[model samples]
Each structure stands twice: as structure tokens, then as C-alpha cells.
Target: MDRTRFFVRVAAVYALIGAFMGSHMAGGGGLELSAIHAHILVVGWLSMFAFAVYYKLFNIPKNSKLSVIHVWSSFIGVFGLTVGMWLYYTRPIEGMQTFNTIFFIVGGTILLIAFVVFAIMAFVHGKFISEE
Candidate 1:
């Protein structure tokens, strides 16, 4: 699938998951899980997905290595962040505290890099405008 479609699909899935989790939280579900769900849905799903879709729809060069890097970094970052948070909350390991912190920080940094790369790609590639 194209990047735009891929991003949209990811965003939609995240939104749906968020909604389900919200309902569960409202019904007095676990607070830690709820917080993790919110983080994944908001940062992982909504924000990252929106940025990816915007970059693609704006016609950023598909051939750019930066694009590939952005996609892979984002996927890995989100996966790591989610898994780290799950482990941290469930197991509550003292040593893993530092490890989880590193995961979150690295993941966030990678995501930020993705956004920067996307913005640069978009600017360099230019937007698609219709002739008047």
C-alpha cells in the first residue's frame, strides 16, 4: 500500500482501539493499562499516523531513504515504547526501571526524528497544487 493509505489505516486502527479502551476505562478498568492505552493511541497511533499520512499526501519522494528510515524508526519506536510500558507496569521491576526509561526516551527521540525527516522531505519535494 501507498504511504498515505498505510498511515490512514494505522490511524484508524489506533482510533478504534482508543475508543474501546476509553469505554473500558469508563467502566472502572485498570488505571495503569488505561494510561498506557492513552499513550499508545495518542502518540503512537494518532500523532505519528497523521504525520505519515500528511507527508505521503503532500507527495514527499517515495524513493528517499529518509522515508524508509522514518517508517521503520517510527514502527520500532512505537513497538518498543508500548512493550516497555506494558512490562514496566505489569512486572514492576527495579532494574527494569532504567531500561524502561531508556526505551521510552529512545522511542520518543526516534519518533521526533521521523517527524523532522518527514517535514524536510515534504519541503524539499514540494506540495501538489492544482493549476488555476
Candidate 2:
């Protein structure tokens, strides 16, 4: 029901996953997945968590259409981008790399759109409230 809460929870989950991956590497796991792990931590965990905090701190209405759009677009976009990157680098489908590259591009574009939308929302609504 609460989009901010949902995004925060997703961010927490991503943090756990990223930490686990990092620990696994430190414990001598293969280092080949480092890029994917970094993206997971950065884009998935940090970005989403930041968005959640921004929405909550800014007092954005939960029921606002932009709220919902922000939640779903960020979720889907990050998921696609991260997974596409994982598959692209780790799986290495010979003929499919082109398709994978396109998928990654599309996901990145979507995420960029989400950021632009959020920027618009912030500039449109963000104002210093002076306590009279």
C-alpha cells in the first residue's frame, strides 16, 4: 500500500544480497562477478533506499500517481538492468549478447526516465516551509 515503504524494503533486501556477495568474494569466491555485485549494491540498494528516504522526508503523498509510478518504475528498471548485466557478463551467450545489450540499454533508459520524473516532482513540490 505504501510505495515508500515498499521501495525501502526492496532496498534492504538488495543490501543483504550485495553484502552476501561481497563476503563470498572476500572468502575466496570467484572475483568474476564483481561488476554485477557492485551494480547490485549501488543501483539496487543505495539508489532505491535514497529514493525511499527522499519521498518520506519530502512528505510525498503515498496515493499520488507519481508515487506509484516512481515505485514500480524503479523496481522494474533496476531489476531488469541488474539481471541483464549479470546475464550479459556471466552467462556470455554468443548470439544473444546483442539482445542482452539491448535489454540493458532499455533498462538503463527506463531508470533514467524514473530519475527525470523524480527530479520534476521534487522541483515542482519541494519548497522550504517557514514555520510562521
TM-score of each: 0.73, 0.86
* lDDT by residue for model 1 (36-125), tens: 788779876887677665665565567868778777776676667666766777667767777777776777677777668767766665
lDDT of 2 by residue, 1-132 (tens): 876788899999999989998999889868988998999999999999998878766767666677677777888889888888877887676678888887888887778878877877776666621232
- The candidate 1 region of ten consecutive residues with least summed lDDT is 123-132
For model 1 the local lDDT of residue 81 reads 69
Top candidate (TM-score):
2
In order, candidate lDDTs are: 0.70, 0.82
Q: Candidate 2 at residue 92, lDDT?
A: 71
